[model samples]
Target: MSETVTLPRPDDWHLHLRDGAMLTAVAPESARHFGRAIIMPNLVPPVVTGADAAAYRDRIMAALPAGSRFTPLMTLYLTEETDPADVVAAHESGLVTAVKLYPAGATTNSASGVRDFTRVHGVLEAMAEAGVPLCVHGEVTDPEIDIFDREAVFIERVLDPIRHATPGLRVVMEHITTQDGVAYVREGGPDIAGTITAHHLVINRNHLLVGGIRPHYYCLPVAKREAHRLALRAAATGDCDRFFLGTDSAPHPDGAKESACGCAGCFTAPNALSIVAQVFEQEGALDRLEAFVSRNGPAFYGLPVNEDTLTLARQDAPVAYPDRIDAGGEDVTVFDPGFPLHWQVT
Candidate 1:
């Protein structure tokens, strides 16, 4: 007999809906499964001020499908020249949700990110005072540091110091990919939390480089060893409010991804809920699925749990999902979990 589970509609704590054609193509996929999402702010020029955030929010609303109730929670990309007053004003007006910190050259379109952390101290202080959370792309870009070691090094060299200096600052370490990251969040107080991506829970570095280089599986803070993957699985399945779903569902054109130097991201929004449900069932943590995807994120963000519900059912036949999302002129590949998916959102 097939089993089914129904829970409150989930919200994506971290998501990337690129502007223009890409946004129009993928926003509906997320809207179909999640009620809201914390939209990333690393566009070409980046969203760095209250006005930028407000205008971007308008574009997102315009891109949404007719009659869709999905809401985009906007964020500001932090830079050295970022005005603390602008961030406060944005939060007060509900034009922005949080501020994103991307270390210089850490990931795509991050060239404009902060190089000297001290320069943003005033902005961080203002965010703490306004009760606005800081969503961080937790990786250091020092060329000397190995790519796989960036996240772990970031915690010790950067994250810890910043949090210690700013009291009462709420932070969400976005897309944590290490055992060290899991342990840090497990031990942190209520003021700190971490978001675990859907793809990270399923793939490790081996999946990206085993027999051949799989660009579709490649992502920033690139997947770590199998042990780290297991740690991420445990954190996501455990009953901790600090750990929640964030599909970092980034999309790139096929040509761009298959090139000599491909971008780093996994496009998983098309079937994120199904992929996550399969993982939860495999780990024998199906009971905690609702809390992980629905309750915890809203509680951490100080928002209300969604009133609507989503239902997933296990079918005898494997679930079928589109292999790619057609973004106007280019095709964006969907993440393949290397296993047949049986659970599907209904």
Candidate 2:
């Protein structure tokens, strides 16, 4: 006998659909599972302006398979020189859903990110007034801070102060990987929420470092200790609207990931739904799956839950996922949850 759960088609609140060939290859994977996604804008040059977001959205639409209803909710990449009026105007026109903040040198293609938050003060104020949410890659790039402590330090040194000063600014702490992150979002009142990645809920630092380096498990705001992973699971599976799903389903080609200096990302787009469903079930909170994946995100973003539905069934046997997906010629590795996956979206 099999148990099944049907929910509104989910959204990926934080997703990376990289441009050109990579975009064309991976956009369909996300579209196949999610009804809408707040697409990341950290392209090489970055999508900094309204025009850039529009053009990128057009490209994403063109890349999707015909008749697919995948809506790419676009975003602007924040920089020190970003204009407040431009940010508010884009949100008002519905040209972009949010503005992304990737602190300088924080992650892939983030060299153009902000080092001086003070420079973007007016823009943050304008966003607050206009109800424009800011999706942040919540890690500090300070060289002195230990890599594992960046997220907590960032919250203490940067995130809290910013939120205090910029009241009413709706902030989504994207791919939060710490207990501190969970606690902050839970206590930060209505204006702040956190996105927990499928990978984070499933993997920890051990999965990345134990028994040799697993490059595919490496991601920005990299997975933390098992305790942190447990907190994320509890947060995602509990009754908390402040936490939602954002696979951060970043795809890097095989060569780039398997390099002398490998890139940090996990291409989990292909199996995100299945992985998430299994995690929810294991935690004995399958009842909360709909809210975490489908309902909570739209509520936070001031959008409606998707009318369409996705069905997931628990099977007696493990569901097989491909080891790699081809991008042009190179293969992008799919995330393996380290445990058998029984629940699959149909």
lDDT of 1 at 175: 98
- Whole-model alpha-carbon lDDT for candidate 1: 0.94
Which runs in model 2 stand beyond 4 Å of their true positions? none
List, residue by residue over 175-293, the lDDT tens digit for candidate 1: 99999999998998899999999999999999999999999998998999999999999999997779999999999999999999999999999889999999999999999999999
All-Cα superposition RMSD per candidate: 0.9, 0.9
What TM-score would every model get versus the actual structure?
0.99, 0.99
Q: Write the per-residue lDDT of candidate 2 for residues 71-161, one digit (tens) a residue.
A: 9999999999998888889899989999999999999999999999899889999999999999999999999999999999999998999
TM value for model 2: 0.99
The deviation in Å at residue 43 for candidate 2 is 0.3
The window of 10 residues in a row where model 1 has the poorest summed lDDT is 1-10
